[model samples]
Target: MKPRLAPYLFVTPAMTLLLAFGVLPILVALLVSLTDMNLGGLADYSRVSFVGADNYRELFGDAAFWQALGNTGVFAVLGVPAVIVVSLVIALLLDRGDSRLFRALRAFYFVPAITGIVAVSLVWGYLYNTQFGLFNHLLSLVGVAPVQWLGDPVLVKFSVALVAVWRGTGLNVIIFLAALQGIPREYREAAAIDGASELRTTVSIVVPLLRFAIFFVAITTIIAWLQFFDEPFVLTKGGPLGASTSISLFLYQKGFSASQFGYASAGTVVLFAIIAVVTLVQLRARRIDAED
Candidate 1:
């Protein structure tokens, strides 16, 4: 192969997989959304019929769909900031030392990220239990009444978001740590020579250098939160009146539970549009920042 074409040849497998799995599925879902396909349609092709924009119209008017979208928005709003801040802070603290203890702590913090969602959900389920849970027990010691972590509609959003944040921060912490380590020690030394306080040095010197890493983490975190499902599915099952139902969970319930595949596909297309628009905006903003 010519040198000019070698890179494309090397990437052919990945591009093929992306087209087959990623691009094809979106196209398929878009087509499906335009139909009135259901379980019966799956069994009998003749039963399926194109419904045009009817499903989209109904979806826009759905209270449950709106609620799920709102829940997902709240999840992303709460999770993205908390995840970025907590992980960055932990990474900063961990990076301050190169001791074996610090290294061990880095791995320790990452445990949640690699852990199976089912296991995390099971443990947190016990913790969120109203009566005999550890959180309620802790509150009792402080003369507080038992709090229903996952029961109250208003509280359930925060409770579920908190679990997601905790689970999410682990990987981000590792990312930030790697970025921090890549920063030159000379920058900090120069800041010190300039009589800069530790906080000032970190704010002025360290953080600006990690902007790219922060932006990367932010993008991934936003996408993950938009597709929020695992915790709610395994822990709450979008329970207590669907308070914790994310868009993904809503789609799951509609597609699998109610066998409304066409409706679910419409929702999926809407979600894809939302994510694409948000990400493109972020990329544009980042490009603007880079230019300046």
Candidate 2:
């Protein structure tokens, strides 16, 4: 085999799978979105009518979809920064020590990311319980009235976002820690020789060097929060007036609960477009930064 053809040959199987599963479904969904396909239509193709852009038009006018989109935007806004900061801080702290205890703590922090979502939700539900939850109990000790963590419409967004932040940070913490370790000892030693404080060294030297890792985390974190679903789905089910309904959950409810597959497909296409645009902008910014 020619050396020039080796890389493409190796990638061909994976590319084929991506095209088959990813591209094919997207094209199929685009086609379906143009029709009024439903449960009844599924059984009888003759009953399905070609609606063209009607679903898109209806989706644009949907209050529920707009609400879901707003909620998704809020989730991403709250989650992306919190995850990046929290994970980076934890990683920085953890990287300072090279003991067995620190190693174990690193693994401990990551447990939430790998744990079952249902179990996490069940535990958080108990914690968020109005009457007998742990959080209210703690608040009571401080002479504060019990606040509705999940019941209040305004507060529920933060409550749900907090859970997502906790769950999401573990993996990013690991990523940041790996990046921290990859920095050479000489860099820090040289900074110390120049009389730079630990804080100054971190702020000026460590952080700037981790730009690529931070960028990677930021991009993935943004995508994850944009598609936020698990915690809301399991904990609140988009809850008390759809306060926590993310775009993904909204699509799921529309497609499965209401069996509005065509409409849901239209929403899915919109989501794909949003993600693509956001990602493209990020990539362009990164490229510009690299050039500068």
* lDDT tens digits, residue span 58-159, model 2: 999999999999999999999899999999999999999989999999999999999999899999999999899999999999999998999888899999
- Candidate 1: tens digits of C-alpha lDDT, residues 28-96: 999999999999999998999999999999999999999999999999999999999999999999999
| Residue 209, model 2: Cα distance from true site in angstroms | 0.3
Task: Write down the RMSD of all candidates, one decimal each.
Answer: 0.9, 1.0
Give TM-scores for every candidate, taking all chains together and pairing residue i with residue i: 0.98, 0.98
Per-model lDDT? 0.95, 0.95
- Total colliding residue pairs, candidate 1: 0
Cα lDDT of candidate 2 equals 0.95
Question: Over the full model, what C-alpha lDDT does candidate 1 score relative to the true structure?
Answer: 0.95
Mind sharing the TM-score for model 1? 0.98
RMSD of 2: 1.0
Segments of candidate 2 deviating more than 4 angstroms: none
